[model samples]
Target: MERQLPNFLKNYGSILLLLLGIVVGSIVGGFFPEIVAWLKPLGDIFLNLLFAAVIPLLFFAIASAVANIDGSQKLGRIISTMAGVFLGTVIIAALCTIIVLWFFPVDAPQVAQETADELLQGNPGDTWGDKLVRFVTVDEFYKLLSRENMLAFVIFSFLVGIAAMRSGETGASFRKFLISGNEVMKQLLILIMKIAPIGLGAYFAYQVGTIGPELFGFYAKPLGLYYILGAFYFIVFFSLYAYAAGGKHGVNRFWRNNILPSATAISTCSSIATMPVNLSVAPKMGIPAAVANVVIPLGTTLHKDGSSMSSIVKIYVAFVLIGWDFFDPMTLLTALGITILVSIVAGGIPNGGYIGEMLMISVYGLPTEAIPAVMIIGTLVDPMATLLNATGDNVAAMLVAKFAGARGTLSAADGLNTDDADGTD
Candidate 1:
């Protein structure tokens, strides 16, 4: 009986099952939207399970990684590598969007009166220092438990980790606790993922049933351009990055393991929600725990190639609406700079895209009337924006792994959990 089992099942059973679930859900939702609308909660239940487990998991994983660091020098190298890769990718994404907009050119659509009037007032006058303080810290420690404050938690975890490492025998004992907690979290996640195929399918069904038709709405033309551009960037550029990180093997591993995170991002439409999936997928992709834990969490808040790309398109669309020149040299340069900043600030909090749009408006001195157009643009682009934002974190981790040469129970070469020598995944 055992001999009848196939090796392909052993290697790829979960992935195939997952793909099947997505397809089935998408098809049913497409053809019979009313029937599948209620299944959304099933998906939410699955996301909630992972979210509950991940709060502590993120703490232990990140704190333990820092606690176990051999020296500050190596930690600096890891951090430096992470920052360099983030900056490089954000720049590339921004430049790509700028170049594409220059050629294709988004003309403003005649937005509906309701949309232009629907926008709420935003306080765009907040200074950079003010934004930084709020983003990096919360008034109370308990606030860190919220997923929206993930960046603050990242900072806290690093401090606690360093303190544990510095505290002699007591600290060493604490470090063990952190490591054990991290392992427990990983196991908990593996068990949670047993239901992923079903959960993700249900979620995809909800997404397609509820939201798919909106893509063909009044804003379809500009939305279409951004969607096509986002897709092209997601596939072509990410593949190039993977190849650069580890050649064909890197590309193969990245593609195989990334589907879950990509799906989760599209379904949940939040980078923070997808972090756990990325954490689980990272190990299976051979990302060192240190690199995976840090980069993914930080990337959840700090790295946003999709958001950056979308910001440029929003700028172009808003400028067009306001009767401003889209390509004035100094003004274009400012928009490019805003793309990087908006990517960071817009994603740092929940529902922050609204604030990002306001920032763009304030910076460009656009009339409040332009708000509705960009707001709609943001709404339409969010799912794909999130996919790129979340999955690109894993890609950045791979590049950091290549640059930093992280060593532990796993090696990039070991591709330990990545799979057999047959492939990196």
Candidate 2:
């Protein structure tokens, strides 16, 4: 009887459960708002668990992936190709967003006078040089533990990985140890995820209940548009990329295997949370562990198609609210540059879109009063945006593997053993 359950549901049951939670929570919250409000802590605890795993998981996964690379020249080629593709795709996404916004302009909501006054008073003084300095160097080792310093940790990990790779036997031993640690972290993540449905349910319920259905009605037009465009990118853009990297069959297989991860990203609204699912499925999709390990972790930090799209939308919305001409050549240029930069650094941050919102304010020279307005748009569109980002990471991995001269599609045997930390047969 248990075996009679459908394969897709069994495989993606967590997402189903999460959706159930959302629906049920919304209903209960709608009828009895006070009870659902009390459930907020359940969701908060789960989110914290997910965030706790991110820093260590990223550090170990990335370092192990780089150390495991066969040689420096090969790693160089892979990294270069991957970076080019990542940037190109993000630019394309941003352009598409701009085009869409140009054709269908969204009216921005008015900010409260008090809110505007509060927002305009703060000074963020973070220049490009300051950001660069922060990225490349940490003032203290402990600073790396802070969520805002993820880029610094990534840089440090890359150097450690390269040094370990060059250390011959010593490096090899260390790499093994790092790999083991990564495995342990994956296991920890799995245990945390076991309770995700409850956490997500409580969270979504509280959100929907407190905000009420009127909130959706208020933002429906823009949110609906964002979801439609995001889906187009996920299904159309990714499928086309998959077809190019592999073929018709490869596209079919890639889409089939990606269901769970994409669903998870949409439900959780997190690319970081989706990493484990991507790592597990990459092998099944024929991506080499060496490539998946490096690319997926790195992509989690550097690649963010969903956030890029969301940023473009937010910037456009902000422009309309502020009465700025978005079509100006200089305006377009600035948006492109800042969106790309913000998307790259936005990953691994706990609040998702808060940092990106600040970058838009700083780079676009918007009034500090604009932050609340931009955040509203971000909150509305984040889930769909994250779905695109998480799914795009898998597509990026496949493309990187192909460009780096991986022989056609490797078998599942060539992939990582997702069941164990060591990934052994």
Candidate 3:
């Protein structure tokens, strides 16, 4: 009976939870608007628990992954792959920003003087020098990098992974420990997954009910644009890159092999939670365990293409709201460059979007109140952002796998076999 219960839950849990969150959140939003306040904390608690697990998971997964790389002679290849990822992300960001600016120019709307006066409240960060100083200081820096802090945690985890690779036997033991830890996390996450449906339902219901019909208009156009770009990038840009660089069988098969994991990431919107699936799927696509291990974990923190892109868009919206033209050539160029730079530097931190957007607000001398607007933007665009982010990571892993010359997917005789029927061919 005990064994039967585990199996039953394992099969049906996620569906159950999703329904529960929607029902609960919807009911709360519809009939208990006043009690909606309590539901907010419940949502926050769930997110916080998820956030708490991210940093440690990243640290172990990355270290273990790096330590397991097979080929000593492939260092140059790995570096080249890393370069591809960096360059590809920058290009994607530039393209996204330019396209959005050109197509979806936001018109300024006039609000009452009193309403504008009310919005002029709040302070974001500081002056350039002051913020830069704060950014570089050890304490603030640490806070920035922690998983809860996110950016700092990413930086530290990468350093630790590198150090672990060099530590020889201790590194091996630590790697084993990390692998074990990751498995444990996977089990715990499976448990969490059961409740996720409930949480998602509740959250969405609350959001839809509270925001009401008027809020729908606020997101309509921008959301449309976001989805259009998201699809274009995924289907055209990524597919082209994979095929061009990976060969027909190679890239196509890789995509097929890893679709489930990528889909999971899109649905969950949490890269850290998707790691177990990624690790399992990657090898099927011929990604070496070493490359798979290192790339996916590291990518979670660093390659938030969708998140950062949405952020830049939010700032543009703010500028539009403040009655500034968004397409002034110089302003456009500066915004693109700044978004990419700040996003990269702030990578690996918790809520890097928050920090990056705050930095942008300071840098541009924009009103601090813009943060709430940006937060709304982020929330609305998160699923698409997570999808792009997960896709980017997979592409990065493929490139790395190619460069590493790892054995698995190179043979044509495999005839599109995958580790699992759902994974890359």
Candidate 4:
């Protein structure tokens, strides 16, 4: 049992982490509440470092991808495919949030008004007009790029890369600089990678130390539910979508070919970190360079089905905990909008969700402290989300490969030659 357990657990780190988080969160919440305060700082430190790497990683990745496109720009096809997957994922996430709300129903147990009041009292914010003013200022614009607000950073990088590509010698030098910056960030990320396990462990320990055993009930089943929902959406719905968009072999070949990268993404829990593996595996999977180059990096920041799942689940938790009704169409629409917007905005930035949540808390007037609780639930399910996201990306890559008319090989899924299939969409 001991030897077998190791193998089983090795293939199931996400599940193990969920169990660890629950048992630990519960024990800590119940018995050692006092110590949670001390450990909280460690968790904060971990988040800070995690976020610090997000912007630079995104900047170089976007710049590098934009600089490498070949042939007549099939930009339209690429955008459409990405948009389809993204919108579909968002819709599915909204469904997940609603289901979670229906099942859990946070309002059944009334939360104290005093608790809500206390949270708001401590966290102040500007009015809408003030915020708009701040957002429009030139200083804020630069800060947005610097802060790694991925949407801005992506736009900035793409524009810069396109301009540089057009500028001949000067552009070549600029591209080199961006490439060099990316390499430097890569090295920094590698250093951070060594400590990731420690950070994960410390964050887990801190969460476990604070949340008592009773809270274990929250993660045990809901966590599993979220993972299964994410898998169903990607493996079933999105896979079918791939077949419709490209061909049967598109989904199958993509999945089988990129399984290693998918698994690496799940294990590492950092999609950005998994780029080398993804890039290396894409060609072997028969994906074209043009498609693979643009799709994967953009997908890492833009196409986050995993984070989408988290946003959906968290929205449901918010409504349920606040005792709001999910059956209301307005409520569902609000959740959907927030999930998509947050997914896009946050997916762009390095630790986009972390910052995005602050905006959410202020905008929606939800309990800010509850952010930690939502993260606890989301992080537990993140690995599964990553697997789903990686799978979706490969599927998209295959579709894009077909459209690009690049060197194609027989898809591993059904032994069909995509290049010879002769398809027009």
Candidate 1 colliding pairs, count: 1
lDDT of each: 0.73, 0.71, 0.60, 0.59
lDDT (Cα, tens digit) per residue for candidate 4, span 376-399: 665567677767666566666665
All candidates in order of TM-score, best leading: 4, 3, 2, 1
Steric clashes per prediction? 1, 0, 31, 15
TM-score computed on alpha carbons, candidate 4: 0.62
Superposition error at 241 for model 3 (Å): 2.0
**Per-model TM against the reference:** 0.58, 0.58, 0.59, 0.62
Best by lDDT: 1
The residue-by-residue lDDT of candidate 3 on 1-425, one tens digit each, is: 89867755654454445545555666667767776665555555554554555455545545555555445524565656765675567567666766776777654444412244544443466676865444334475446444333434545656766776678775687767766875665555455444444445545555556554343455466667777887777777777656654677666665776678667766665666667777776766656666776677667665667765776677777675555556788667657765665545444443445455555565466654354445456656766877777667777777667655665533422465454545643
Model 3 TM-score, all chains together: 0.59
Q: After superposition, how far is residue 325 of candidate 4 from its true place, in Å?
A: 9.6
Model 4 spans with C-alpha error above 4 angstroms:
1-29, 48-114, 121-168, 186-212, 246-302, 314-375, 397-425
lDDT of 1: 0.73
Residue 109 displacement (Å), model 1: 5.7
Tens-digit lDDT string for candidate 2 (1-425): 56546644654465566557656766776888879768888877875675567578667766776677675335776788789879988999999898887887765334322233443432378887885686457899998875556556767877787887878886777989988986787677677767766776676567566556653454566667788899888889999888867677557657767888877886666788889999998876777777888789878877889888888888876676556667898789878886786676566544436556655665555664455446556765767878888888888988888878754343323343434322221
Judging by lDDT, tell me the better candidate of 2 and 3.
2
Alpha-carbon RMSD, each predicted model: 11.1, 9.0, 7.9, 6.9
